[model samples]
Target chain A: MVSIQNLHKKFGKHTVLDGLELNIDDHGIIAVLGPNGSGKTTLIKSILGMVVPEKGSIHINGKPLKNNWEYRKEIDYLPQIANFPGNLTVIELLKMIKDLRGEAKREQELINFFGVNKFIDKKLTNLSGGMKQKVNLVLTFMFDSPLVILDEPTTGLDPVSILKLKELLHKEKASGKTILVTSHIMEFVESVSDRIVFLWEGKIYFNGSVEELKEKTNQRDFEHAIATLLTGEHV
Target chain B: MFKILKYSFFDLTRSSWSYIYFLFYLLLGIVLLFLNNDLSNAVITLMNVIIILVPLIGTIFGVMYFYNSREFTELLLAQPVKRTSIFLGQYLGVAVSLSLSLVLGLGIPFIAYGLFQSPAIWDFTMLLITGVFLTLIFSALAFNIALSSENKIKGFGYAILMWLLLAVVYDGVFLLSLVYFQEYPLDKFSLIATMLNPIDLSRILILLKLDISALLGYTGAVFKQFFGTSFGSVISLSVLVLWTILPLLNIARIVKKKDF
Candidate 1:
């Protein structure tokens, strides 16, 4: 589980995240939805300790992340676009991460479930956009770390690859790994997320299950429900 | 620190081309030795310049290599690795790699030439080691610039300025001071000023080996009194090591707190 309390992040005069509080429980796929620059990436980055918050703290599994960085071993992150050195073949990159993690079983399971075998020998830069995203997905799953934070995980994937990813994600969920994902692709969010966190204007507008969101908006689908909530004025 | 250094060594080994220029320099050293059958004073003077130039090349390319690898560096930072490890690892990697290449390129020939010329082997070896330390000092400065600057042009510009200062301008200014301070005992001042630049220190160490420390004019005598002893040389080298380490420490701090 993760807890974020009253988080405020600013870049110079621009406040990207302000007075934001949210909690995530164990073993659920939570999809964060927001418009551009609505602090989606900033929130994920803050959780991963890529960006420092101006005010407040984030706790992962009862322990606060510190400058010492021992907390990071429990987390895996997939940025919107994962880039590596052009010379790094998929196997080398994965091997390097595996070496860094120093884990055996977790690395084996993640690599197996993610189907990293297809492009294991391919250089990262030479892969197609979809394949590159798959490589990122594979690495994110590779360590089997307890908490996985993925920003736009399904972007650039073909329908088949997307389906394959959903299958793997559901299996991971059933096995009780906490996942926090952010995506603009509403359909995938609608299908996969157990809960939806609607962020608007640097604040959490709504936090509820997908069905609950639809029920509150009186809509049939999660997408239309979120659209109504995001466009409406009242919280 | 050891882990960081280990990872950095592997990273540099993967690139491989960074050492090519040093190999070229080594080949040049062998050719220089090949040309001088007698190992005359002229060859010795040219070798003096080569000693300084070896590390100069190391600093330039080492800075550029680290700068070029920024994307990989960013990715590495996001991991569980500590900032200090990352900083120290990369610094030591560049320092060690360049030092090895330089020694291979220059040391082998220097020794082979020494055997023929009857020059003091220990003295020459000491000078080579001093050159490597000097190279590491400037490489650290250049590495710090690359790490702190977002723009490559700005980082490179700062690197060039650093080289100009230590390698060229420092000597020019010292010569100017010598002209101005002709009447006074500027020996101590000259020694301190020369020591301020690692390049000058390296030059003096080499000159000291050739028994031409006197030709350094009055400052040479001052250096002879101050750093002439074996202990004095070790202290000066330690000071150079400190100079290399301190900026890298500051860089580690900045890199830790830096958002990217």
Candidate 2:
């Protein structure tokens, strides 16, 4: 379980995260939906301990998150901007990450499932955008870490690769691995997420199961439901 | 510590073929130092290059390496490893690579000259190796500033300022003071001033090695009397080591507390 308590973060005169609190447990995928500059990225980075908060604290798996890097070993993150050294090939990148984590075995089945094996030997810089995203997804799922955080995971992905990634996430979910994903794509979020979190103005406006959000907002579809909840429209 | 050292050497060795250009320049400098049978002029010319050019090259290389590896540093910081390990890895990597290049560039040719011409010249050649490490100390200081700044221009600007302060301004301040204190005893004070600049320290040590410390007149005599022996050799080496240690510790603190 991951818990954030009264977290506050500021950059000089402006506040990015304002006394925010959240709780997540081992479950199927939870999707955090927010517009740009809404502090979604800041929240994820804070969980990873990449950004220090001025107030409050976070705990993961019964341990304080700050400076407790042992908890990070259990979490795998796929950043929104996935970048790697251009000189390294896809296979070499996988190998390096595996070696760094000292993991004895990795799940390479995603590679074959996603059709990435055809160009696994090619340099990352030479691959197409969708192919690179596939590689990033494969690497993130390489270890069987309990908590996986993927930001904009489906961006630039072709239809087939996108379907394959959704299938992979489902399988990981079935294995009881907790997943937190942030994406602006409504349909993708609706298909995979069991719970939805809405962030507006650096605070959680809503948090509940997708069905509950639909019933509470009185909308026929998740897209219209989100629009009504965000802009407060009756139609 | 040992893991960092091992990986540091590996990182340097990975770029072996590419950095041969650095080796080439080093060899050229040494060959130019010993083209003549007369050792005095060659040593003087070599000292001039070591005192001035080596630090400049070191600063450029160090800054470029840190600036280029920014992403890798961010990735490393995200891992479970200790911040000190990351810093020591980077520092050792830069220091050892520069030191090896120095040895290959200047040490080999100096040794060959000592063997071919006269064995007694070996002491002076060893003194030259000491100066190479002094270059590493100054280079490490330049690297710290480059790594801490995210803006490339700002980082490079700070690095150049450090280079100028150690390489030129420190000496300029001392030389300007000489005119004002013409009557006072400034000989002992000059040695103290050189301590603030590694380039000046290299010049003083190399000058003393060539038995030309007397050229500075009364200051020369005082310097030689104070630091003319093998004990002086250790002090110079310690001063260089201090430069490496202090900057590395400072950089480690900044890196640990920094939000990447």
Candidate 3:
């Protein structure tokens, strides 16, 4: 339900997204895979209107996203870094977000699912990296928005939590929610994402299912296929 | 905007620095009043302190808050809120909280000393107004500097340089120019120079209102002739307003194109 055309973004002399175009119409897990500095986060932020494109247009659900904010109400974002205000308790931060976005009863359910109820009263600064990531996930999923854009959602998660996250993604996908995610873990991406959009040099290089990517790259292994895509070596 | 402002205000209110700043002014007011034993005299003392100190505190606090709240800012950016509202709300939060500290801090002691019953109430009010204006002006400028500079140390350096330039270096240069051009008619020049610096403009505004121009010598007389009138106060106050507005406008404009 998102369309981007001729998107161009630059930071100083370094061009992040140049004449790039992307479209997302499916309602399932879409893992955006790219190497470091491949404009993955830039692309996501562009859709969220956090980064202003030098020259291009973005549309959400057929409506132009130019100078618009109301469309964000339909989207929930999980930033790569869980850098919350340290002084706020977990519950206060959740309540603050709820207040900003209007009421949402799903927060309690997500909090329970994430098992962050014990850290509810503790300040965010005191939480471990994994706990902070759990809190971030709760904030992102609690809103029950139609679209969710998660940037490296699995950072600092324990194995059990990662499993829990995969299950959570499956549940959301089953509910017909369009989820956009970007991550480096090939195994996690292979297991969770139904559609893979591979990015190279700020442009989409490949878009297909896991089986199709394997057939094209001639590598049965998912991680090796991504490596082949990057290295351009015959498998 | 108000929602963001509310959260920011609440966040800042909980920070210990706000309390330290508030208590500083409160203690300063009480000590100055008890020591000077006169409302007018205490205001004069406060005028000197506020003119120099308010801008410094504003610049430091503004930069610190902007850098510290960066993660929080990014979190808010992904939300449905408008870009300008986030920056403006934070700016107002810093400025208003500081102004509150200055008012209640100084207000407590002065009112305790029966400031309202004295004829110097207007002078006291002018002092606080100038303090608030300086706080707003410098904090907006600091936020602009912080927004432009991504490096925290660099942002802090620029902010402090800004305060030093306006508070100290600007006056030094102003005095040097006055001396170098002694043979020329420099009344208009000096008045314009003073008007350009918010700190100087505030000092002149309060000094003239307190009728302490005699101690200011020749330039004071010239300033007295101009700032002593109602027209001069209106113009000076408007310029102060302009000072606060221009930086805020720059903030809005810069934030629109900024990457983060």
Candidate 4:
């Protein structure tokens, strides 16, 4: 559903994404894993057109994303940071997004699932980080978009909410929606993601199923395999 | 774009700072009218205050809002909205809200003091128009600075420096130059220099409209000779419009290539 080719990005002297290419053709959960400053968020933001790549082309659903914004209508993005206009109430924020994107389906259901109804009337500044993340999740999953991108989705989430989030991801995947997530939690990545795309030093280091990754690294567990990939040591 | 404008306007209008700004003008208008006891005199006093204060407020508020709403801006950027619309809409939102504060805050007291029936009605209107222009011009410049500088403190420092350069330093340098070239014909040169600075242009526009060129020195007379004419008025007004447009166009250009 998304194709990125020859992607090159740099922040000052630090190269983020260099000659990287990624293409996904299926509807499932794909976890983007990387160490710090691995260009994972850069890649995601590039797809969302938030970060303009120095040299690259991105196509979403067979349509070239250059100078085009209408395709974003089919995608829902959950930003890593949940900072919003501190003065706006949760409902006002929701309404504003809904107004911008047109009618949103399942908004109420997602809000109920996240149990953020009580905080709807409160300003965003008053909410705890976990509550804010819940609101972020509600905003992301409410819309009936074909693609959902979550950056650090589990940040500041309670265990119950994390379970809800995993359930929501599964439900969306079951409904044939493509979800792209970036997280450092190996257990969460191993449990939910159908395919793992590991990025190392501005390039895709590994792209395959968990079993394939284990077989390649010859490691007994997923986390060790990731460590092995990073250290380049044979077990 | 309108949707973004609507939200931004609402957001700004609700902020306490907008009310404080409005109340400041309101109190200033009432105090000025009560103290001067004449519509024309009060307008003159207001002309001095507005010329300096409007741009300062606009610059500070523009930078503050842009930096403050950054995450929110990112949220909008990821949406289906066009990039230009988001920035332009926010810019307008700040400019328009500030203009409203200047107008209504000063306006209520002036109207209360029987300003509409006075012959200075046109003068008051000119003052307001100039105030709005300054607000738009400075705010757009501030947004440009904020957009180009990622560091908030640096952006704010640059914006204030810009305001200081145009509002105060420009005049000082102009005076110095006119003194250095006292033997030469500086009328045309002074006029062009004044036109280059929005603050100076606004001061001249209001001063000429108020018909107090005699209070001004030789240069003011030269400005009066130019700005007093119909053709000169049109050119000066167009220059103000151009000042507003150029920064906005820069904003559009910068936002397109900027990495959020």
The per-candidate TM-score of the B chain, in the order shown, comes to: 0.85, 0.85, 0.97, 0.97
- List, residue by residue over A168-197, the lDDT tens digit for candidate 4: 899899999999999988999999999999
Q: What is the lDDT of residue B78 in candidate 1?
A: 64
Candidates 1 and 3, the one with greater lDDT: 3
Say which prediction, candidate 1 or candidate 4, comes out ahead on DockQ. 4
Candidate 4 CAPRI classification by DockQ: high
Of models 1 and 4, which has the larger TM-score?
4
Instruction: For residues A84-169, write the lDDT of model 1, one tens digit per residue.
Output: 77787988887776776676465656556556677789888888878778778877777778788889998888888889888988
Tell how far residue A233 is off in model 4, in angstroms: 1.9
Give the 10-residue window scoring lowest on summed lDDT in candidate 3 chain B: B212-221
lDDT digits (tens) for residues A48-123 of candidate 2: 8888888999999879976666677888888786676566688877776676677725546778777789999998
Query: What is the TM-score of each predicted model, taking all chains together?
Result: 0.89, 0.90, 0.98, 0.98
**Highest-scoring model, DockQ:** 3
Q: Candidate 1, residues B27-142: lDDT per residue as tens digits? A: 76677667755444434654567555755665686678787666666666667777667667778887787777777767777667764356555555665677677667777887
Question: Clash number for model 2?
Answer: 0
Kindly list the per-residue Cα lDDT of model 3 for residues A24-107, writing each as its tens digit.
Answer: 998999999988999999999999999999999999999998788889999999999899999999999998988888888688
Poorest 10 consecutive residues of model 4 chain A by lDDT? A226-235
User: Candidate 1 chain A: minimum summed lDDT over ten consecutive residues — where?
Assistant: A104-113
- With candidate 3 superimposed using the best TM-score fit, by how many Å does residue A76's alpha carbon deviate from the native? 0.7
In order, candidate lDDTs are: 0.75, 0.75, 0.92, 0.91
